[model samples]
Target: MIPPVSAPDFLVKAGWPGAAIVPLAGDASFRRYFRVLDGGRRAVLMDAPPPHEDPRPFIAIAEHLVADGFAAPRILARDLDEGLVLIEDFGDDRLKEHVDAQPDNEMTVYSRAIDLLVDLHKLPAADLPPYDRAVYRREVGLVTEWYCPAIGLAVDEDAYNCAWDSVLPIVEQSASPIVTVLRDYHAENIMLIDQPEAYGLGLLDFQDALAGHPAYDLVSLLQDARRDVPPEIEAAMLARYKALASPPADFDAAYAVLGAQRNAKIIGIFTRLWKRDGKPRYLAYLPRMWGLLERDLAHPALAPVAEWFATNIPADKRHQALQEFALA
Candidate 1:
């Protein structure tokens, strides 16, 4: 994708005239990123077109994270009307690629990530929206609304809502302290930066952050949809966080609930990206998401939702069905 028409002027105003703008990446959203190079200096230009996207929340959250000593990209300049922002470049090393290249270092890197979250949870939550029952219901409802229809299954929508209603209160009453939930805190969004002070990880894609249960972000990391985090590593990371943070007895249950909730939302989202957004690449990840969701459903805390799934979606219609659909 070409840079937005206003990008050159914005870069010039930001003091980087005649910089080379190269496409960096585009995510599941309308936002696109480009790398800006001028002489020896480099920065990233975020193009979040308005009407369908906004950069204000990203700007606010980035500032908050930087001020708190977290390694969020520092915003250099912005134009709200055009939805453009020039921000610091965290370079090319993503935690996902790093772990994939050096499997032996997975434990060490994950320990550092867990420690970062432990420290992060100690701070006061940012003044953001709460991840409450309404948000949880809406997110989890995506499975019923999008995925089920796409797979040609007419589920009991009311029963699905009721199943979630029974178990969401468990998450709300979790003993862990509430803090900023970087709703998409996974390996791909984490940059392996060179700064030791920033714990070697630079945060990204946290604009949708909310004040919610601590387990939410942890679940996002260990139960990643795009990558496979071995069950042993997931267990070790959980132990590491619990030892560092001393969260209450229900932390495990909270993790399971949030895992199921998040995975369910992702399955629906991937389907929607294909059906509504015409982006079929995301469908490749559906099987992995279903696997994680099934594991989460096995937890005793998820019995209500588990029963709902067992009754509505037979075993053949879960991951296997998605695989067949994708191949077709």
Candidate 2:
């Protein structure tokens, strides 16, 4: 919760004075942000819910990304005491909105955007924490537990075992050292705005960036929340990434595993979001996204686990649950 600390008081505390403050937009998180207007300069103020939201990691990663030449907004002042940050405003324009209005230019923008991943993944992540086996397994468990309950598909023991068994091995075999996995590296998080470099992707909503595989972020981008990314574009991005990063020949297999894991978690998340958060609009995206998960499973890489999803989880039931919304 942002205290009643006046914008003037914040400016005074930060040693910058006389700035007109305006509220910025925020999403479904404990954090609230405001875009401050000071003279001709602008900055963003972040108010994170204390106790539940920690500013330390957000500040730490912000510093690292800025130092690495990624266009993360500069952190001007972070009041750890109040869970507030007076940071540079990266503008409000996101890539999803940009390309949605101008579909003809998607490939051009995305090709440049995909290149940014190369910059992020090439760095050493020794300083970052791990998105290790424990977290990975727990994330998958959410799908079976939360998402399945919405449609009443309690995955049997064998079915549950099948998913983890196939996915766990691929994750373990990835052997790729951990890097800053921007957990939700989608178009909405990226600002497609004016910059000296054409690829100056303005990043927002990155507080959840973790230490994990490069493949994880890639999956996040290609399997985006707001749009159905074309298959050719996805493959092209992967090919471009592989050419530069020199990931193993089986990186695609790892990507398939990560994609399945991520999409499953999202299916559960959309279900939970609607049922728990009172945000039912997300439910509209399930049909296309479910089909996406189904298509991903067709890959031989995901064959072992696909049967569990198909056998234990019937599509007819998924469609039936979906019907609950249409009639509403």
Candidate 3:
């Protein structure tokens, strides 16, 4: 509960001068956000304190997304040295809250989200780290290094690395056009902006954007780790995306590979959050994420990873220990 060190001074210097700043909910990152009210104007004050969080990538990516005609928040003012930025407030209508409150809008909102990806993927992934085999392996490795140990399962790092070594090639072989993978493009990060001339989806938490398989973001959208997107809706959206965008050869296989990779990484990440970070709420998502992981592992392309899971983690044992840890 450490208050953002520079937020107060930064806000005053930015002309808010003790404006009514209400704390907004933070995400998994170290960054904190506040809804700042100054007279009749309202903006979001982002506190991305340095050493732990950097504002440069968010700033650069925001500019890049805005330049590309996307709905990323406009950076009204910034102090990169202090890792703070005052950005356009897109209001409280996060796509998750919108769709959850009105289930009927799920289809329309999700369709438009997929459409945003279609438009976004048409452009190339510009200057960013490549989401290649090495990076992917390291990410999923969190499972072996932290999760397995936490669940009292011995991990052979060699075998775990070997399992991913077999799977990474499939993800890399996609013939589809690669685009900037917005690392997190789920319901929560998307904003519902109803305007005639808008991208319709206000993007957030894209500081970790990278150059990688186009299917990565799609998986993030459809197979969300935090929420359940109805199976029928997910299927239809996948079909719709394929129909509208001529995805490359082996798109389905590539999608499955990326899905498995991302889910496996999440499984490890959630466990670490509970055991090390003492964030028990994240543990609740483990069962849901396990289901998603199981679904992804069923894909033929992920057989190696699947075999590794079956041998190491039986279905009944998957989240049982983690659940107990959550209660404790």
Candidate 4:
């Protein structure tokens, strides 16, 4: 991947002259990150090139998180016109790898993450766009818009949306307080940093933060699209959050609704990444996503959505169908 042409000058202006820029990572977006090494000091340079992306949201959210005593990366410098920003590096100890290596510490680490969310929800949400029903419908529509067509299944789009319409209101009308929902709060996006202020967790990829139901981020964490959070751990963590937050009695239902919604969105997105963007690596996660979606669909709150899946994308047409397509 090519680094931004203006990155060098931006870094130099930000006081990191002649820093060695090393490729770090890229997500499912138009952004790329690099580690800028200047002698003994190191920082991350975000290259969110213009027209397609704007780094303002990330900068604003990062500043908000830091100001609220959270462990989001500190913004060292920025050039909004070029869509480049120099921010603090939280190191490479991502929660996903950390847990994968030491399975025994999973509960302890996840418990801390849940506690962080509980604390974060207590604070007033940042000025951000609401994760309203329109957003939900647009996101969930990705499955039908991308996945179904990719697999050559002409689904009944009307019925599919009808199912979602029946349940979207439940989450939107949740009794729990609306809070800043870090749209991608999974293990991969979290760094196991040494900062106590963030309860040893360094947040990342929160540029798409939104004011939504408290359960959305929790669902994102427990029902991770990229990793398997053990069933027991998932249950325990859900219980732990309930005990700490004392959310509404229907919180479990809200969790299930959001979980199903997010999983469906990921399925469509991963497919689009493969078909439209020519990035097929994301296809490998289809089975895991389907598994999580099935679990969420089993919840009584998702009756309509579950029925839609059963009738339209039946058992054989789910992940198995996608696997066959991949092999073909």
Candidate 5:
């Protein structure tokens, strides 16, 4: 996902007087980035599409995290009206890429990262918006409207309705106390700052942060989109998170329901990405997500959900639909 040299070129040619520039890689999003190497100095350039990708919220969140003790990339300069941002270069060591490539050092790496999430959840989020039933329904309903229609399936109207009906209440009731929820607290969004004193992770892509269930991030991390996290590793992480986080009342039940709801919404979204955006790589993550979906459904609290999925989403149909989307 490395962008072309255009951005770096623009910065070097038109940026600060006598500044140097170098293009760096970017991830899959509406955003693009470049490295600014200005006469032995360094900075990163962010190119968000003007009128489409706003940078104000990103600016706000990045500053907030920095003030809150997280090593987010520091903003050097900005042009909100033009949608450009110059930030400190945090290097190319993405947390997901680093851990996946170094299997032997995986646990040590994730343990450290998990601790960061624990701290984030412990912080109060009284001001954040609620991730209520409406939000859950909207996310899941996207499947019925966007994904199902794109795939040419009639979107088993009855099934889509019943599926969410059976699942949302379970998710809502078991929801844990709210916290500063970084919506995409998954691996890809975290950059491992390869430094000495601040070996802590650098948070990125957090403009979507809100206040909601704490376990949501843990699931997002363990059930990552780009890699296969081993069951043993996932178990180890879950146990560690539970031990560190003393959940209120019936935490176990709430966590399970949340996981199921999360996985289901993810599956639909991945499918939608394939059909709607023509991004087929997302389909590869489906097989893994489906298995996780089944496991989460195994929780006794989600029995009705399991039954609904079993009756409505046939094994052959799900498999065939996924393949069609991938091919499409």
Candidate 6:
């Protein structure tokens, strides 16, 4: 990521000149977040300093989420020119932290999350960029671009894409009315709210939401790159979601295809984080991600991708790659 250009003086410029600001955790993007305080009021200050980051997409998506009766932070103020926005503060009870503290409640927690998705899927996807085949192909191409070289495998971009080309259409043909895909909808980005009427979940990091296949966010949630979701919990939640929502004609196959695509893309992304950005912590997720990919590959619809992995990356090589990159 490029260095942040300058601190936005927007809050000071707009009345609360002495608002207390404290740094919060950031993700892979160029955007930074800060907790802001003024008198008794609290809000989140998003520092999305541009030429590298944009705030419009975030504001648009947050509006959509709120309009749909979901728990997205309320935008209090904005200065798009400076890439700054002050949003409501949904205080600390991230789903991941809650799950960590009470593992037994995992099923209940996931079910509630699934309920939110079921409601969201009923509505029309917002006017946003489509997560179409071209996008899927480009993203999945990450595995070939970064991962293969990291593990000392030969590069053959055309052949790799050819393999995915055969499989990706399965997703395109099966998807129905698209829904808002909060592309990063997972445990880390979901905050558990305490208020009874507040939807029980707070959405975050959704600037990249797109009109995408419904199964895409499901895959993101179940096949989380950052955590080891229990096999039983994943299976149960998937079943629960399918039972509640009227899914597409080829829902199972579409889910598998998107899961495989997401996992493959993540492998390359984690490798890039290590090699290009000096972030090795992401490398530790590689082994788990590999395991998830292998499971997704077992789906019959993923035959071509599975075959590609089998021929180019044998089990021994796969294990070797994991051992080489994963944390001890």
State the lDDT at 160 in candidate 4: 90
State how far residue 8 of model 4 sits from its true place (Å): 1.1
TM-score preference between candidates 3 and 6, better one? 3
Which 10-residue window of candidate 6 scores lowest in summed lDDT?
Answer: 1-10
What is the C-alpha lDDT profile of model 1 across 1-328, one tens digit per residue? Answer: 8999999999999999999999999999999999999999999999999989999999999999999999999999999999999999999999899999999999999998999999999999999999999999999999999899888898999999999999888889887777999999999999999889989899999999999999999999999988999999999999999998999988888899999999999999998998899898888898899899999999999999999999998888887676577568
Whole-model lDDT for model 1 versus the true structure? 0.93
Instruction: Give the TM-score of each candidate.
Output: 0.98, 0.90, 0.96, 0.98, 0.86, 0.93
lDDT of 6 by residue, 223-319 (tens): 9988889999999999999899978669999999999999998988888888788777787787788899999999999998898888887776663
Question: Per-residue alpha-carbon lDDT of model 2 for 117-199, expressed as tens digits?
Answer: 88788887637667777777777676776777776566685567566676667766776656789888898889876664637
lDDT tens digits by residue: candidate 3, 34-145: 8889889999988888788999899899999989888899998899888889999989999888999999989999999988898888897878999998889888998888
Q: Report the C-alpha lDDT of model 5 over 230-289, residue by residue, as the tens digit.
A: 888888887888788776666666667777777778777877776666677777777777
lDDT of the candidates, in the order given: 0.93, 0.76, 0.86, 0.92, 0.72, 0.85
Worst 10 residues of 2 by lDDT: 319-328
Quickly count the clashes in candidate 3: 0
The TM-score obtained by model 1 is 0.98
Evaluated against the true structure, the overall lDDT of model 6 is 0.85
Positional deviation of 321 in candidate 5, in angstroms?
3.8
Q: What lDDT is reached at residue 193 by model 6? A: 86
For candidate 4, lDDT tens digit of each residue in 1-328? 6688898989889999999999999989989999999888999999998898999999999999999999999999999999999999999999999999999999999999999999999999999999998999999999999988878889999999899999988888778898999999999999998888689999999999999999999989999989999999999999999999999988989999999999999999999998888788898899999999999999999999999999888777777667679779
Q: Who wins the lDDT comparison?
A: 1
